[model samples]
Target: MSRFSPFSRSRAPQLLTEVLSRTDAFAPLRAGVEQMSAIRRDLDALLPDYLAASIEPGFIKDGKLALFAAHNALAARLRHLEPRLVADLQARGWALDGVRIRVRPQAVKDPVPPKQARMTPVGAAALQALSEHLEPSPLQAALAKMAARHTKR
Candidate 1:
């Protein structure tokens, strides 16, 4: 007869710490604010699914978390459902300071469109044409500025 043990080959605990990165997530959260860019990608890759786009954890100030919902829809859902979310994260060993969600109206302004421009060859041609043809009028300059700011060079 084979012995059954939690440490057995088939039943042994996985490398959970390595898998989930048991080190404090506070570092990434803090670094995110300083960088101010690439936050979505960092969070998307590291954070758990339930808290990925659904919740944004801020800080551990005064033993409280300042969280933000990515959109109004998620905020609305969290306003009444945070307790459960919190419970689930807690079960997964997430020691968060109570979750607080702030609704982001702006993030919902253009759901389908990418906030950052990802131009194809055709879009690049269109831009080059506009740049060459458009005169340096105030309106044109403003449009150019907007395009430059939004498009990742």
Candidate 2:
């Protein structure tokens, strides 16, 4: 392995917090992130589980609290709750003019398919019987092999 890999640098790795703290624009960026986190916490307390789970506080800027939802359905629901959410944030000491609900869909992983259904004994028997009527061919051979798996030993 090369000695120049990022993790193998001669100097100790600088923490992200340290690096950001040293940057000029980091204060506003960090404050925005923190405010959003607080908004999420407040939403968790104020909203129902179904809404809270699907919704996220995107950012607060220009007197607008932007909310992100996982899909259109949730976005519509959040839009309906806009006034109440704005009130809640105001109650939490956030100075905001409006709430904007946007559909910012999170990446969805494809669900692993369920295990294949096992071949039933009757179905296997049927396949075996059908295979017997056909001349030797790839289809007949495949059916016979499959049917044999379900045969009573």
Candidate 1 per-residue lDDT, tens place, 1-153, comes to 557765665755665434345557656654545433343444455555765757665654553445677777767766676676566555655565566667654343445754664666556556656866888787677656655644655
Steric clash pairs (candidate 1):
none
Question: What lDDT does each candidate get?
Answer: 0.58, 0.85
Top of the candidates by lDDT: 2
For residue 20, model 2's alpha carbon misses the true position, in angstroms, by 2.6
**Candidate 2 backbone overlaps, count:** 0
Measured against the true structure, the TM-scores of the candidates, in listed sequence, are 0.34, 0.60
List, residue by residue over 1-153, the lDDT tens digit for candidate 2: 575878766877886567767977898876766677788889899898999998878777799888888999998888888888889879889899998778888899899999787888889999999999999999999999989977854
**Candidate 2 worst ten-residue window by lDDT:** 1-10
In order, what is each prediction's RMSD in angstroms?
A: 16.6, 10.9
